[model samples]
Each structure stands twice: as C-alpha cells, then as structure tokens.
Target: MTYCKVCSLSGEHPGIVLDEQQVCNVCRLDSVGDLLVNYRYTQEVFEKFQRAGRTEGAPYDCLFMYSGGKDSTYMLDKFVTEYGKRVLAWTFDVPFESEHAAENIRLAKERIAATFVVDADDDGIKKMMREVFNRPAPRKPGNYLDEKLPCVSCRTFFVIRAILHAYRHRIPYIALCADPQQILTMESDVRRIVRGFYEAFGVALADDLFRGELEQLLFAHDDELPQIVFPFIAMRHEYDPDLIVAELKAKGLYASSPMETHCTLFPLLNYYSFTHWDCMFYKLNASSHARAVKRNGADGARSTFSLKFPRSLNVLEVEERLRTVTLRIAKGEGAAEEHEAALIDAFRELGTSEEAGRFIARSFLEMPAVAADMGIRLT
Candidate 1:
C-alpha cells in the first residue's frame, strides 16, 4: 500500500518505481520536464495545427467531439467563446451515456453557438460491445488493459467517427475533449483490433464493404486525415478538476449523479478491472494523472518515465482477487450489486432484449473461464 510521498501513486502495483529520494518515475519526469512532448504535444506542433486549421471556407474550423462530460462541456465553451472558433459539436449516442451527460449536451446546445450533431448505430455498437466483452483481449504491457479493453475500443470508435465526420463536412480540424489525463493514443493497435471485432462475425455480414470503407477513413493517410486538436494540450491550460466541477454546477451543467458524469459503464468497467487486474481506474491511471498534474501545475513539466512508468501489474494479486469475486458472485453474496445496477441501467438504456442482456451478462461474468477455454491467458 506504499505510495510516492509526492504524487500518492500506490506502490502495490508493479509499475510505481521510486528513486532514492522517494520520488516516483512520473514525478521525476516532471522534476526536469518532458511529459507533454512524450504525449505528442509541443508548442510548435500545436501552433502549426492552429495555423493550418485557419484555411478559409471550411464549414467549421473544428468539429468538436462532445461527450457531454465535465471536460468536454468546459472545453466546448472555451473553443467557441474564448478561442472564437466555429464548431460542429458531435456526440456518439451510446446506451452507456449517463442521463446527466445528456442533460449537459442539451444545455450546451441551448447556450453555445456551436452546431450540434448526434448519431447512433445501436445495432452495430451492440454487436461490437458484445464482441469486446465476449472475446479475450490481446494483452498489452503497462496498465493499458487496466481500463476495460472495451473503453479503448469504444473511445476509438468515437475518435474515428469524428474524423470521418470532419472529412465529410470539409472541416479541417477535429477537437477531442477526452479529459486531460487521458493523453495517450492507442490507435496503432485499434485499426486492426476494432476491425477484427466486426469481421469475426462472418463474411456474409452486410457490413463488409462499408466496414472496409470505414477502416480506410479511420486509418486514412496523414494527408487525407483531419488534423486533431487535443483541447488541454493545445490550449496548454492547467486542468483543475475541482474547479471544473464547481463551474459545471454554477453554470447549470451539473450532472445528476456524481458517479455517472463520465459514463454509466464506468462502474462495471472498474469492477472488471478490479477483479482481474487487482486495480481499478484510480490505480490504472495514477501515473498518468500524476504526470498531468505535474506538467499542468504552477510550473509546467512533462515526463512519462522517461517511458515505462506503468510497468507490469501484480498478476498474483489479480488472480486472488478474481477468485474471490467469482466465488462471491456465484454464491449470491451480494458482492457487486453496484456493478449489476450499472449493467442493468445500461441494458434498459439500450432497449436490449432481456434474453440478450442476460446472455451478455452471463458471458461477461464467465470471461475468465471463457478465456481459458480459448487458450487466452489473462492476468
């Protein structure tokens, strides 16, 4: 349970390495400064994007990816009023979206000058989600898998959708509003990973041609791709989460449930990670969070190791926790009513048939055995 004195990152995980001064690797990166560049953020690069995106006659300067979460809501206002950029705000309407987030989106539409676009492909998304939960995901080093692999796949879908949307509308820039702490991009594996999730359904599937087209759009050549703008990185603003929460409340953008501003699936994802990874998002992202705070602090700095800060997780602890939760759930010990509650709400939101939801639930819960049967090693 030991943690870095400076950053509070738990040492229980195999990743948190502390130097003689009891400072963490992440903290050390910030001591001299290097985190922002590692995350692919540089003043020159950001300025270049700004200069390139100002071309005349583009329908909008930026196509904002609005998730209706705290970060996106705040960033949307900044992009429009402060930066004075015309924006086409977009949302990928998923069943996993929280009611509070929906309300925030509604408020933003009424108040902000940005044009709004919302779309959903429930049938397609459901199949993709089911695939993510049903199959064993390929292991990646670090805490990459610490967040449910579905979160990665789903967010990538959101990013890809925004890119294609920008291309279609002749928008030169796409604005991503993922919280500042979520600085890393895993698109290198996402193109193939997400493609396999769909193509595995079968060749007879009607999406074959459209699927290929979507892939090309998702992984288009640099010349063909829309330049992306990471709000916090580009703006170089110090992200104060507490302040954002207070402002959201003062501005009437407060989400109803505190636990749900991010997503309804969050709890379930944490449960999955806690059971299998011996860690949850709190632990999964501690290093990243620390790095963000360091670089965005009163004095700016950046460090991601020097790379490898998240190191491998404690697999033995994960195994024991998994066995405990599995047995407790099997015996109806009421160990995870909260997790099931979120899942139930999600099913209701999706209008999923009871039988289908139950099947998904059963399969997701039995994932460990399923992975074993498929000869996939988890943990």
Candidate 2:
C-alpha cells in the first residue's frame, strides 16, 4: 500500500509505475502547472463542441446522462443555464434506485424543460447485476483472482446503452460528469474485459457462426461510437459540495444527499477493499477527495485516497460523515441493511425465491462446491 507522493493513488493501482521519487505515473502525467494549462485548453474544447453542436433545426444538442447526483445535477444546470443547450437527459434506472433520485429527476424535468428518458430494464438488469457481484473474479495462472469490479461493468453497460441511444437518435454528443479516473479506464478497460470474456467463454458456447456474430456485435466501426463530452473535466474548478447544495436548494430542485440507494453488490466490494477498487468510482466524486483527506491525514493509514487537491470542505465535517458511513456499514445498520432489503424485494419481484437468488449469485463467485451442487454451467 505505498501511496504516490503527489496524487492519492497507491501501488496496487492498475498499470501503476513508480520512479526513483516514488510518484505514480498518473501524478507525473498531471501536475499543478499542467492542470492550469489544461483548464484553459478544456474550456476551449467545450466552446468548440458548443459551436459545432449549434446546428439549425436540430432536435437536441446533446444527450446528457443524469444520475440525479450532485455532480450530474450541476452538469445539467450548466448545460441549460450557461450554454442554453437543448438537452435530452437520460437515466438508466436499476432496481436499486433511490426515491430521492427519482424526485430529483422529476424536479429536473420541470426546471429545465429537458426531455427525460429512463432506460429501466429492471428484470434483466437485476439478473445481470446479480451475475456481476455474485460471480468471483477470474483467476490468473497463480490462482489469484483479478479485480472483479462490478462498478466497471455497470458503467460499461451505461456507456454502450447511451452510445446506441445517441446513435439511433442522431445526437451529436453524449455528455457525462465523469472525473479524470473514470475517463482513463471506462472505454479501453471495459472493451478489453469484454473481449477477454468472449475469448475465454465464446468458443465453448458457439462454433464459427456464433463467433462471427459476436465479432460483428463487438467490433463496431469507429463511426458507430458516440461522441463523449465531460463538462466537469472541462471546467477545472475544485467543486464545493456545500456550495453546490446551496445552489440546488435555491433553485428548489435539491433532493436528498447522494448514495441514497444502497447497492447490494457494494458490500462485496468493501470486503475486497484490499484492491481499493470497491468504491473507487464513488471515492472519486467531487468532494470525496477533500473529505478523505480531512478524515485521514496525509500520513494516516487510510486504504482509499483522492487524486484532487486544494480542498474546499471543512475537514471535521467530512471526516464525521465518512466515519458514520463506515461504522453504519460495519454494524449493518444503515446502507448495508437497505441494500439487503432491496435485494430481497428484487428477488420477490422477479418471482424467484431467495434461494434461487443465492444460486444465481453463486455462479458468479466461482465457488465450485456450490456451483456443482446447483448444476450450473458457465459456458
């Protein structure tokens, strides 16, 4: 668990390289000076995107992925109020959506006059999610499991679905509030994982015909991919969560705080926190960096780290929140319980027994004893 001197990254990070100074490659690639320049450069890119997107008689300027979270809410605000873009806000709802998030979506619809779309494949998605979290990570030659990151799988699905939607609708750009870490891995890493999955299991399931079909389905031409745009990355300002909260409140569109929906798979990730990939996405949120720093000082032995600097939050407050969440999860009182209840309800909704859910989940974990008894086949 050696941490980078510059950023909040650690030695266990994927493809991480350390120099004589022990700074991570990502930290070296990004510096305070370079960041200042990038801020201006990104602003130029945003303006250029805006200009190119301003076509006459276009139905919508950009397809925005709105999660009703603070980051995305700010993105929606800037797109509408600052740039005055005609946005089509799309939300991919899973079975674990929070009531508060739905409320925020409702308010966003009223506030922006934006076309709202929810891609909720509850039954299908529940099965997929179950598979993702329950299945164990793939094993290497040494019998060590790789990072079975459900977050990566989840985001990849969102990107593919968003791309297809934008392509069908002739949307020019697909906008998201993704941070630097997500931008680095979402496309390349996810595609690699998909190819690996097919390579490993496709041959067992199909002959040449199915293989050809799979190849065509996966290896789409460059033109078929959607144009991605990130407003938060472009606008290089340290986000103040409290300030954003105030803005949302003033507009009368603020719902409850983020992470209101407890994901059933999240507990599995926490248990695998050695990789620090469990809640990596959430940890990279706007203010989480500052929060983590405030709670655990730079020298403290904290498992998670943030890649941002110049914190705007009060250290004590952020530390308290983080501690509370950690304790609640450990005690099975707050989000953990919420996730458990949601998982059970989802099983009932799908007309499946709890044991059936467990059976389905075991297939993901690669537990041979249970999988064999259930007569499950991976290929």
Candidate 3:
C-alpha cells in the first residue's frame, strides 16, 4: 500500500520498497543529495573569447544584450572600454518593463555614447508570453535542472530575437551577461549552442500543441541567427556586485528609479518557482543583488514582488498578484479580489487543497536539502 510521493509510484510498481513512513524508495532517495550540479565555467569561456579574437580584427565584435540593469551596465562598460571591443547594444523593450528601466537604458546610452537598437512591440510579446504560461509541458525530471516556470521561455524568446537581429546585421557573435554559475556551461562553440537549443526543444516539443502557437506568435518566419557568445562566462567569479554597482554609479550610471526592473515578471516568477519547486531563485539572485547594493552604497531596493520589497510578499501576496494580473487581462480592472477567490475555489474543486498544503510544507523542508545537494551554500 506504500506510495512514492514524487512520481506517485506504488508498491505494485517495480523497484518499490516501503520505508518507515510507508513511503516508497523513490521518494526516500530525495534526501540523499541535491539533484543539479554546481559549476564555475565562466573563466574558461572568457579565455576562449580572448583567443578567438572576440575584440581584435573585427568590424564589430559582438552585439550585447543590454537590459539596462546593473550587471549589463557593467558588462557593456567592460566590453567596450576595458576589452576594447566594438559593440552594438540591443534591448528588448517589453511593455511590462518599469519606466525606470527604460530611463536606465537611456542613461546607459548617454553615458557610453554607444549605438543602441530597441525592439518594442508589446502586443506580440504579451501574446507570446500568455501562450507560454498556459501550456503544460512534461514535468521536468527531478535530476534535470530548469526554471520552475515558463519565464525561461520568455527569456528564450528574447534571446532568439537578439540572435535573429544579429544574424540579419551579419554580426558573427551575440554577447549575453549570464554568469557562469548560473548556466553551469562553458560552451561558447556555435555548434554547442545550436545543439543545446535543438535538444532542449526539438523532441519534447515537436508534437506539442503549444509549439504551433509558439511558432505562429514568435517564430513564424525564422531567420538564421548569429552565434551566442558569453564572454563573461570565462571570467573568474571575481566581479563583486557591490563593486560593479559602485563603479557604474561613479560613471554616472545610477538606478533611474527605485524598485524598477527590466523583466517585469522576474520577481513573481521567482516567487512561484520557490514555492512550487523548492528552488531558491531569489536567494541565488540575492547574492547578486547584494553585490549591486554594496557597489552602489545605497539602500537596497526590493524587486517588484520580493518580500523585502516595499510590501512584504507572502503566499497571499503571490496569490493576489497573479489573480489581479490575470483578471485585469481577462475581465478588466477592479475584479482582482473576486478573481483571486475564484481561482482558490477552483483549486479546491480540483481537490488540490490538501495537495497544495502538503506542497508548501514539503517545499520548506526540502529547500535546504535541495540546496545542499546542489552544492549551493546558503549563508
């Protein structure tokens, strides 16, 4: 009668054994270790970028994906001023981005006198995001690492768009600001990039109904995009966030507004991810955020949906935000509370009330275990 809590396997299934609590062996193994491996590959990637003549002998070395955030600001400064690379800065101007982020973009351009390009079509972006959020792909296996929500899909759209832009302009490389610790890969080879994309998407998504919607909305007319290069991936984890923020501010690159974000859904998505997947995204992000604040030497501002933000965001806050946004889009303003209640009721109707309750308790207990498994030390 014992059952596995993870994949829901029972004693009737093969390789099942009952533990003291009558849970199956599969669920018991969850406590053995963290599933995803941690790695530092940035330095290796950076060295490759240097050897490949990323900055020397090219008309324009690369296209930088600038988000006008503290990290990207420092990245742009490093690429152009420090590395002596000819660069074109690009921003995907999603409508949900705070006004402050937009101002930061303007400030970065002014400060660097760098050439900039912006792609600002809100309707298309919103539609694509909605489709991604609504689709249900096969749940990721426990050992396989992924973002807890579809927000990763949103990031992918931006990345693909940037690559397509680089391809159209004949740029050989597109630079991104992903830290090595974040991605766990030192791959800078174009073949690796293409293969990774295909592997992540091709088979699992081939017959997915959402694939059609994604293609229609985001990739109807596909163009060969330039190879993505992560120059920072090769640098050692020596760039402290606080130091970078301070340096940028000294260069007159200050936060344009308090509590603004380049990606509107980042906080909310992180919150949901932590809740459902036992992923400590914000904690991971907090390390970088702390660096930014220290470098800026200013009072740290909270992310839009962070508990440390102006208003403490608890589970209720998460529910309220999601309910409000979804209802505003579906029914218009002033229906948020009603919508929130309705969604909660629907969960109950689906008999997820106890499931949700258990998930919350398990997530809290499992987080430390998962973190330990991943070799991520929580201070």
Candidate 4:
C-alpha cells in the first residue's frame, strides 16, 4: 500500500490525496493548524460549560453517553471527580454487549453517578442495517460504504436519544467521550445521513423503526440539537489505552482489558471500501490524526484505535488486523464468527431474510467499477 511519507497515511484511506512528494493531502494542508484551531474552539465551548454550572441539587448537570468503555468512563470520572458536576450516565445497550460491559456499567454507577441503560431497538436496528446493506449501490463519487456505514445509524440513534434525554431532564450539554478523530467523524454528515435515511424510506417506516418521539428528534434542525461536548477533544488529550485501563482497574470499576472490537459490520465495510474506493472512513480523519502523532511523536502519542491513525498502534498490530480481516473476506468468511451468530439472530428476530446478509456480503466481495474509475486496479 502506498503511504503519505509525511503523515504516514496510505492509499487505503479516504480523503487522502498524495502529492508528487508522497505527502498526504492532510500533511500538505497543514493539519497541525487544523488541530490547534479545533482545540481552541472546543476549549472555549468547554469553558462556557464550566461557567454554566448546574442548579444546586439538580438531578443532573449533564447527560453523558457512556458505553462502559475506558474513554467514556474516563469522562465520567472527570466530570464527577475533577469538575464535581452532577452527571447522569446514559448507555444504549446494543444487542451484542458483552457481560464484561455490563459489569463495567455496574462499577461505573457505583463509582460516579446514577446510570440509565436504554435498550437499543435491536430488531429495528437490524432492519435498518438490512435495508442499507441490501439496497443496490447508489451512484456516487466515493464508495457508498462511506455514507452507508452502520456506525452512522448507531451513533445517530444515541445522539438523538441523548438529545431527547437532555430535553426531558433539562440538561443543557450532552457530553460525548469521543477523541479528536472520533469528534471529527462524529460531527461529519450524521444529521444529513439520518435525514436522508428518513427521506429515502418514508416516515411511516422510520416511525416503525424508531419510536415516534425519536423520529421527531432525528429530524430536528442542527442548531436545535443539544449542545454536544467533547471533553478530551477540548483538552487535546491523547491518552494511552494502557493508562486508561489501569486507572479504571485501580478504581475497581473495570472488569476487562482494553479490546478494539468495533461493530461487526465495520470489518466488512473496511474490506469493501479498501477494495473499491481504496479509501476507508478512518482516512477521512487522517489529517487530524497525523497532527496528534506529530505533536506527541511515537513514544508519547497513543493510537486512536483506527487504521487511519497509524501512529497510535504498533505497525505490526495494525498490519495484522488489516491483513487478517482482508484474508477472512478473501476466503468468504464475511463477518467474524461471533458476528455471524449475532447476525443470524438479528435476521431471525427482525424477520429479515437470509438474502439480506448474502447481498451485503456479496457486495463486499466484489470490486465495483468505481474502483477502476479511481485507477485502483487489483490483480
């Protein structure tokens, strides 16, 4: 794979344009300046939040979207311990949540604040995934995978849910646990993609997939949405996964080692996008990712647990994960075995036929004309 010499991003990343010198466009565009600019803005936002303290004895000051992961739990700790803010923790219980995550949730509540676990509409989510995956590819400049990523659907659900929870509770700011790269991606095209989802598939089906109230929340204007907060992003923090896990373990609030298990569909998405677009979603944030690496360097910099953030993980680990998934797809082992089991259950429970899975997997295995158009030819 060809990589940008300066930023170390490769051709497999989305939004990566290489110059004659082999430096990625991110490097060419001066990503360091972008990172600093984002940092300043987010810092201002966070300070404004600090000034607007909660009313004394209010049920909560802010609603935190907690996933029982280290980044989120760290935010929970920071809010309760550092800032002394009354936080209400929210967890969307995706169907594939591990038992370890449940334990982490229990510990989180014990250590910090009251937690509310909202069970995701598993059947509905599955149906949407089925719809997104099974549909014929849309004619677009980049890969449909760029827009059709399941993470968009999942994250949008929580964003809307957090907004609704905030509205009901009178919480002004909804704190997110995303890092700089995640903050960039999370802010990208979420509301637009969701709006398109509803517009494409009638509101009646949307209402069927999501609750009536949530459907309304999804369609709300961008400005009308809750004020979202990114604490780590505001501070420009780059934390080691080891330190985060250690901190939680010391508090006896975490039960498992840090693992980078993304959504089951993510591997499939990565495989197809890399094969076709020669650029994946993670690459979209490469510029900001490169900034973090340059500022901290390899010794001090932590990986963002993304392929685009090559400096975050050791070269071997990154290559192994990428190659492993590629090999799996090449062998017709589409999703991970665990995910295959979950997908089977999802299809059955959601009343989606097996053909939906077949269609998505088949789409992943093919090299579309778009790749050839982009001059990404494979043997």
Q: What is the C-alpha lDDT of each candidate?
A: 0.57, 0.52, 0.50, 0.58
After superposition, the stretches of candidate 3 with alpha carbons farther than 4 Å from their true spots are 1-45, 51-58, 121-124, 136-147, 185-227, 256-259, 267-379
* Model 3: colliding residue pairs: 34-373, 42-233, 42-234, 43-234, 46-234, 241-291, 242-291, 242-295, 246-295
Q: What is the lDDT of candidate 1?
A: 0.57
Q: Is candidate 2 or candidate 3 better by lDDT?
A: 2
Model 4: lDDT to the true structure: 0.58
Provide backbone clash counts, one per model.
3, 4, 9, 1
For candidate 2, write residues 320-371 as lDDT tens digits.
Answer: 3433443344444545445444444333332335654333233223223322
Each prediction's TM-score against the native?
0.66, 0.60, 0.55, 0.69
Q: What's every prediction's RMSD, in angstroms? A: 9.2, 10.1, 13.1, 9.6
Ranking by TM-score: 4, 1, 2, 3
Model 2 residue runs over 4 Å out of place are 1-45, 53-58, 138-148, 188-225, 261-265, 272-379
- Superposition error at 143 for model 4 (Å): 7.9
lDDT of 2 at 227: 61
Best by TM-score: 4
Root-mean-square deviation of Cα positions for candidate 4 versus the true structure, in angstroms: 9.6
lDDT of 2 at 369: 32
Model 1 lDDT per residue over 1-379, tens place = 5567655565544345677777776566542244455345534545665666466768888888898877788888877887888888889998667666888898888888899989777556655556655556435333534445667767765666666677777787777754444554333232453465455454444254235556565466665556666656544456666576688778776554333455655534544555444455444344553455555763443432111122223323433443455445434465355435444443333333454344334433554443444333344
lDDT for 84 (candidate 4): 84
In TM-score terms, candidate 3 sits at: 0.55
